[model samples]
Target chain A: MYTTWWPPITLSHSRRDQLLRALLWSCASVAGLMLVCIVAFLILESAPALSHPGWRRFFTDAAWHPTEDAYALWPMLAGTLLSTGGAVLLAAPLGIGTAVFCQWYAPAWLAVPCRRLIELLAGIPSVVFGFWGLVALVPLINQWQPPGASLLAGICILTMMILPTTSLLAQASLAQADPDALRAAAALGFGRWGTLRRVVLPSCAAGLLTAGLLAASRALGETMAVLMVCGNVVQLPSSLFDPVRTLTANMALEIPYAAGRHRSVLFVSGLLLLLLVISLVGSATWVRRALRHV
Target chain B: MNAGRAWIPLLLVLAATAGCGDSPDARQPLTKLSITGSSTMAPLIAAIGKRFERRHPGVRIDVQTGGSSRGVADTRSGLAHIGMVSRALRALEQRDLVGTPVARDGIGLIVHNTNPVGALTPRQVVALYTGGMTTWRPVSGKDASVVVVNKAEGRATLELFLKYFHLTNAEIRADVIIGDNEQGIKFVAGNPHAIGYVSNGAAEYALRHEVPIKRLPLTTASAPPAAGHPAPSPLARPLTLVTTRRPPALAQAFIAFAASSHVHDLVAAHYFVPLAA
Candidate 1:
């Protein structure tokens, strides 16, 4: 290989490979260092709250009166779970169904446009979605139900915001399904529906689940749209109609004004969110591994 | 070579962290002042700065906004010549810094004009906020559930409200939490059943603009008696300009300009009650 294509003025192949390896290693380490730094910084800043209220009380007690020294975060935690779970529950099925239609049912002309449209929806800024939700969807909800700005509105907005990503990921996964299996299924005289149901989907279960988890993460981290529509109420919502505040919303809304232990507690909330998202992604990986083994 | 390479990143991180401190070049002969902090005070400071700048042609005044804490931090660290804080300084902060009150503002409870209730006792207000009183029927004689609008965390308005009512930040059961005065007022304007609070200046402006919300006065008898304060008004607080040490000459001048009768019209124009007047 060297005899065929040695450059006149270049380092030895071994030296070149070593240099490239070093460069890549440094770049990767820098990125990993940044992640470690962020997590460490959050933990350091939140240490006071963690030690004072202690983790159990931080997780268990519902009241969050930082000024008065009570630091329970249960209400915001519940809000985060409820809204994100609601969004995922609504968006996942619709997103996967759209992907299926695009993969199998939609003609080429329709499919391309549909995918492009979904990408366009994804491109619109979250703040614009928040504004639209605030100005239009909120009032409409209010008219339908008294005091319309609610968890239901937040869920609806989040579903629309997250749908594009979920569907696009699902489509990519479905497209990557084995052609050999599809052809074999057809050869076995299985119809399109039977082949899709029996062969294509099971192989794509991990991918579809990943898409759902990614969508759920987006929903969980969402601040602006939910903040605008969710009413930012600090309560365990009894119904979708009830207003609720997510952790992200609480942080964004209060970070500027918070100081002392109150400030540390907010950082603790950040650590909680980081831990929650990491575990969620970890579970997705675990599920994928379990599926592959099966 | 290997040791030198390892030292490079360590040096870079050190440099980045230490970069914020002022360099010798920053203390040039030019008469420049940088003021940062409380977003609520930012507008007022900006206005005064413009007038001060015009009065002293060669002098430049730079203003920035984060929050009152940023103001205190900036002042303590010498990042700014002066910090603009809307709220009174805490005991810890007062140790290292001196605050000169510039203006006063009151937080007022507001409700939609469509609601028949004109006034709420302090106890009723606390009860309504704490989720104890859920419906308007028991308190206001209106057959509607109370939609308690609240301030987002970190707002001076929210802090002031909480302190006045003898409540903590978390205890208030809010239906909607809004960021700024305009958002709070707009929420109340839109929903007849909603109740919220904002600075008196903002409330007055909203009322003048016919936003369809009314400011409810706390009955004087039930209002928390003024204690350990120069002005015993439960709802009123001073907007203070702070400095870490004895302020520099330029900072002192700026503080004077902000406090004096020169900016009285400007302060009143922004809805603050002028201290001198």
Candidate 2:
């Protein structure tokens, strides 16, 4: 009797399976389509700027006075790159070091709390971080250096904002390390630090690089914290103490009052930012693949 | 399980129907009055709107801020019943829109309280901003370098400042460019050698809170106040509410309410100077 009931049930199950597969495929395509639409919209909106005043002015102009038609984007672009690069250079080592210590060296009682705190830090809003930076960090720096809101303040705030991201990803990568390899290193009479250096680190180099790339991307797109602390001067910073404005910060500050060509130029900035992020993600993927062969 | 699965679609249909029926027009005809523009006046108008709502039931007033241009544009397009313009309307705008003056706000220069400089002439102020004079010693203050803090482009304060001083944006050698009046105040308050300008009303309110900044009196060489009379502000502009040339009855009522003596207390509480009766 059970055998006779099977054919109809199997037929119905296959029908449901086909329906689910079609639904999921459509959902994925919709997401991809939405991304395409956004790119198209940005290009369309920025076309007026690209044609008038031309792209040359964007690269060569001295300052970023959009209302006056001086659209030099180099200073803000440099500000964004320098701040993001400086933040990643400082944050990556600290985050990875914390992850390594918690995984291997920290006692159980300490490690649990440390992990929980990192998780908690990740959940805090970026605006709250910006406010705290403005209230606490800017004044402290002002004591040592006049005009405390500068590129250095922006980098410090960004490093704090992205630490949890790098740390959590590094911890995840460390967990995937082969337990057999660790024991083998111990059997070879290698010290704990030596084992980590020779075996554990080499094994997860790709994952660690991925973790760093993700954190860099996050810092690149951060607006509020950098805007609040970075003094927003449309000039290239000569020193760490000098104030600078990033591309994202410039867009946020001016987009509300922007009109006509000014508004289109802001969209151009958005398009440039999108391209940078894509290239970053592409390079990360390529590096991960290259590291696998080694 | 089949019965439960069947109810899901039914429940979704019921939810969709309920959402559609909950639209304001279907439930009741609510007359919503939309007001837009000028971040400076948004707070004041919002407070007045709350009081108006309490008095007139079934009337709604929506207030939004996106700078004065948006206010002007929105009123012309009929997107808003009234637009809050922080400055007086130009002749071009006055042709299509009628402006009702509600209060007065003046743009004034501010510096940290510790600075010895008490007053700056219009010429001296222009020189400091244009990078002609870079040190405080030139302005009779400390020997330290002067940090010029300027408002970003498109701000009404920046526009008024530039127009009054006859200086273009490119001429300003700003060490730091800040957005909004609060940021400008905060930056000046933090840096002892920095000079920035913001709304007089906003600066006065900050002073009440003991923010370590002082507003300098703006004196022009061309016209000095008569003896026994206080010096009038050279940077003052009217805070006006703009409407179409022929406004609806409801908009007219609200405009009258806004400009009347009844709301003078509300205007003064926000630190704005109430218009003379």
Candidate 3:
């Protein structure tokens, strides 16, 4: 029954399985390699700062002067978290609302073009986004502050950038909701709005959570757009109107000038960013596990 | 023969992609020369690189512009053979890394050609920027509301203007800061209500392409207008070429090319004043 078909010969079942296993192993190896690279680089570059001053200073000190050997992380960390939080808060409701409309109510003509536009937006380079933000968003914020760049400007720019990612994920989540459940709800006397509110939300809960986490991750890593709009002062942001520099912006702005112990400090900051990303991803994994248990 | 001929173009393309411009001597061991920092010194360094290539041929020179402060750090780390900068080394830098002043230049202020106001005094410029004074009624000229423009941070000319004008931590209203010098100049050039500053090397588009804007001379003492003219703007700062080391050989060679007597003519021809000359 398993006779050979050609001189070249057909692949045996075992050979096929072996090939698949090889591919799977190679993919795992690639993932392992990337993780090793990030960890090694972070440890190696951060050696100078770790060796000279205690690791406590990286978390405690307030100033980042290298000459006197200060490596404070609070001001930059606060700015990063605040701006990212502001961006998520502004974009989430709007993006989810837009996705809901597109999926449940928007006409095909409008929805299709709009979806394409959002995808195109995600494809635009960070530098281009920075220029657009500098020209379009920052000026509008300056109207309120009257002559200085501020956290609000950076937030607004980020809101526009994060919209595409959030909307895309939200739409994917909405699409994953069972249409059959909606039809059944209508048969059970539930209105379109009620069905979506009750049946749709329950079914797509995991998808929606994933979408939210994905957007948050993107907001944390965004660099150039924030740098252009944020005033780039390394200080605790007192008000939305005040200028502040985010962690990523500080690293980018100072990395070129930073060396030795200072360079190591930047790597430490990068490691901190990695830790933040890992925690977020870990939370997502835990949520998925809890969903499976349910 | 036909197949081999067909492969020639493909082979050539591959060779080009694999670093065609790389010299056979790229693998050769020679004294490495690295220059980093100061985009303002790009013209001078580029000019020097061309001449140095011909003279030494064997020695490799790498010049980079990482702003002023970055140059100092790179030099200190031994990442670069020499640092090229437009700003002065800080106290730490002087102790850690040596510095040599190669040539001198004056930071020049520029305005759009269409702008009617010719010159600004040191005080008037500051007033317009910070004190919220608008409408250029220079020491004598007719009044026109002035719009201020600024370049991105870390630009040598920008750093000098801010320091000379005493604007440290002074934020420009976000509405006016442009990404690069040319854009700022273009923004001013297109609008008669705008004014900005740039290095002398950056004057071409701001002053040359259309109408040449005048440089406002800055001095502590008051100098009144000439006849029917408003006094020149007294806002000037030195243009400097900074180095991280005492000056490595190739760096010295490049500096020689930039500072040679002929280079003086070249500098002025490009609108920069060669102080040594």
DockQ of each: 0.41, 0.50, 0.16
Question: Best candidate, DockQ-wise?
Answer: 2
lDDT of 1 by residue, A23-127 (tens): 778999999999999999999999998888787887676566677666768898988998888889989999999999998999999999999999999999998
The segments of candidate 3 whose C-alpha lies over 4 angstroms from its true place after superposition are: A1-24, A51-55, A58-71, A291-294, B1-35, B47-63, B68-82, B87-100, B107-217, B221-253, B269-271
Best by lDDT: 2
The order by descending DockQ is 2, 1, 3
Structural similarity to truth (TM-score) of each candidate = 0.85, 0.89, 0.72
Candidate 1: list runs displaced more than 4 Å: A1-22, A143-149, B1-26, B113-127, B130-133, B137-142, B163-171, B204-234
Candidate 3 residue A239 C-alpha distance from true site, Å: 2.5
Clashing pairs in 2: none
| lDDT tens digits, residue span B103-170, model 2 | 88878899999999978998999999998999889777578778889988788889899999999999
The second chain of candidate 2 has a TM-score of: 0.83
Scoring only the A-chain of each prediction against the true A-chain gives TM-scores of 0.93, 0.94, 0.89
Question: Residue-wise lDDT of candidate 3 within A1-54, one digit each (tens)?
Answer: 477654334355565555656667899999999999989988888877777686
Q: Write the per-residue lDDT of candidate 3 for residues B1-277, one digit (tens) a residue.
A: 5434656998999988988553323444545567777666766766666666767767666667766666766666656666776756668767766555645555656664545554566777677766367656754364655556665444556666777778752444323444445555544444445566766556653455655465455545366645532233333344344454555555566666666675665555554546554
RMSD of each: 5.7, 5.0, 7.8
Please, what are the lDDT tens digits per residue for candidate 2 over residues A165-270? 9999999999898999999999999998999999999999999999999899999999988988898988889899999999899888887777789989999998
- Model 1 residue B42 CA deviation in Å: 1.1
